[model samples]
Target: MSYATALKRAARHNPAWKAASVFKVAVEESGAAVLDASGEFQYDLAEDTYALRDFTQEERFTLHQPYDGDAALTVITANDPNSDHLILWEGQFHKILEVLGADALRGTVRYRVKALPQDEAVPIRHSIIL
Candidate 1:
């Protein structure tokens, strides 16, 4: 079977896939934004670290790592012109920062995204939640 078909089947029958949350994508057209796609994918927070130093003589510091606002998403389809698209996941909007990877044979793509500032985020529509 083709990779896409296999992926579709897995998404339908796999327990892990069934537990994943759905995410919506919006694309701009004619000055209006419209829903372009929706899918279920594995979402995870990307690791981020910060260095904190003591005020004493020695230049010593510790890494204060945490899950930053950024996240990694793996999906079955690619969002073209990613910057122009907004993803609504977990009741919040996120902007795609970059494509991490894509595998045609596997029918999957990975992306790095950061949550949009509240002022810039569009409200999520009830119809798009699914």
Candidate 2:
């Protein structure tokens, strides 16, 4: 068998690689939208079509100033090509900034993601009319 196929089989059967934890991967799409009834606009979310897979947090560390904050490195098994892989973990969104994989090791890929900045709290002002 080919090296890529063999690597995949090895990783899949590896006991250390747990398949319990689940996470969502949002694939970026470049296309236009569609118009529906009442002139409402709609687009393919692709939330339902994307595959949910197992990933393990290999490492996490803090980043000093002049750079963004904390970051997490994870390992995921997929034969997908090198591209941006958006991840939704624990209600927080993250984008795969880097990917490391080889053709011989097709099903195993490492991703480094930095958490996207969340919405800031808006202050409400109450003015007094004298």
Candidate 3:
């Protein structure tokens, strides 16, 4: 079997080896205001929700690191030029501050990512009880 194919299979099944994943990305092109049903004008961000939806495999890099105080908090897509890519999770948004890549050896690439602070926020259920 080919090494590249084997590596791809591993990355797909190994959760420990994967880092930040781009699930949904969005970007607004016009940045125009729209009228709501209540007759109020509101800025539309619906188009800005999938900016990175087209990320290619070569552009995806993630390094899963243990929870350490010194781990990096920012992640960048190495091959993408867009500087405003955002990571959407649990109804919150995390903006990608920079672009970065993973080191590859013999057709395998690995990279790291820092989790967004929003993911650490107390759960709504716990907050409601308190």
Best by TM-score: 1
Residue-level lDDT tens digits of model 2 in 1-130: 7554455456457755433212332212554333345443332222211112335544544466354643444444343544444444445555567664333455445555666677722111111111
Q: Order the numbered candidates by TM-score, best leading.
A: 1, 2, 3
Per-prediction TM-score: 0.46, 0.39, 0.30
Winner by lDDT: 1
Candidate 1 global TM-score:
0.46
Lowest-lDDT window of 10 residues in candidate 3?
121-130
Question: What is the lDDT of every predicted structure here?
Answer: 0.46, 0.41, 0.33
TM-score, candidate number 3: 0.30
**Over the stretch 29-59, how does candidate 1's per-residue lDDT look in tens digits?**
4644454245323232221111111123323
Clashing pairs in 1: none
- Model 3, position 101, has a per-residue lDDT of 36
Q: Give the total clashing residue pairs for model 3.
A: 14
lDDT of 3 by residue, 18-105 (tens): 3333322221357543444564432212211112121234343347854342122222222333333334333454444444433343
By TM-score, the better pick of 2 and 3 is: 2
